[model samples]
Target: MEAQQKIREQPVDLAILDIMMPGMDGLQLLKSIRGSHHFPVLFLSAKSQDHDKILGLELGADDYIAKPFNPLEVVARVNALLRRVHHFDVPAPPPEPEAKQLVLGALTLDLKECVLYVSGEPVMLTSTEYKILKLMMEEPGRVFTRKRIYEAVWEDFYMYEDNSIMVHISNIREKIERDSKKPEYLKTIRGLGYKINAPAEN
Candidate 1:
């Protein structure tokens, strides 16, 4: 009854009950608690009361510890149960939506409208040029070899030809760069490959 009153008076994270208490036994107290409360309940019983422990579980007890148990073991079990309750009670965060635009320096590629903006000015792009620019913008600072660029944008196996890729890179630089001769965004990586370099933050 005292336990019941304490539970009613305040919110309880857990309840510990001995199966052989005076007047209202632990089993009876658990039954009363189950009627109106949902906090975790643990049963304490003598090894001889193994049957009572099983019965306590069927009557809605979360766990049971034998009488000859170590105090540390009981404390460990209680902490584990409370950790589970705390973990499960938390709400999961909502997933974020996929990005619809890619940006590098003054360039902004809108995936939905298939448009590229240079310093807030709309720049027209051919389908092939757009595909090439979009791929580089997706992963800024990562170098892309001529073969990789050709295979990705054209969706065909690349031969040892470099003119197509070179022409496209030149055209893109003419459109997005402040000076095609001294390109700021599209950079030649000297015997390696090309990459879109975002301007350093001021």
Candidate 2:
């Protein structure tokens, strides 16, 4: 109760919670916290079962550490999470003087609402796909290596997750390209990465 109250009172930078608390368990508390806050939450629990750890993460815990853990390890993990959060704390940019849209031959990206348009037709995209396409569209014809795309969107270190990025690119192409097999905008730079091209003006 006091913990929740404190959170409601002032800004919280980070939180460390234990899973086996008395009345409101850590998982339940995390759920409640997530409804109102976006701070990083780490779980320190004696329940070392795989299910318990996975459940904690599934409920929004950033990191889970089992009991009998070294205090030094806890410190290290906390610092790492804080650093990751700090990296993403970008300030809002000044209002753009130009129009809030990016355009290629027939595709238009609404920067304000994060919408994509195909030949004047509205196209829907999953949040992940929208981000990937936006990144490439911002710098058309610039090849973006998978590692760069993964890190930019996922905000994590890339671990050779080629299939993950590949699947997303495929999905995006299906929505935006006239022919996914012979993509008009997205191109695979074999042995390198991927890039989105602006269609030549007709």
Model 1, runs deviating above 4 Å: 1-99
Model 2 gets an lDDT of 0.75
In order, what lDDT does every prediction score? 0.73, 0.75
Q: Over the stretch 1-202, how does candidate 2's per-residue lDDT look in tens digits?
A: 9889988887777789998898898888998887755567888999998778767765656667889999987887677566545322234456777648888778898866566899999885544566778899999988899899877765666754425567667777887888899988999999889988876556
Steric collisions counted per model: 0, 0
Best by lDDT: 2
Q: Write the per-residue lDDT of candidate 1 for residues 126-196, one digit (tens) a residue.
A: 44566778889988899999988866754555645434466667778888988899988999999888999
Residue 141 C-alpha lDDT in model 2: 89
**Stretches of candidate 2 above 4 Å error?**
1-99
In candidate 2, which residue pairs clash?
A: none
My TM-score estimates for the predictions, one after another, are 0.50, 0.53
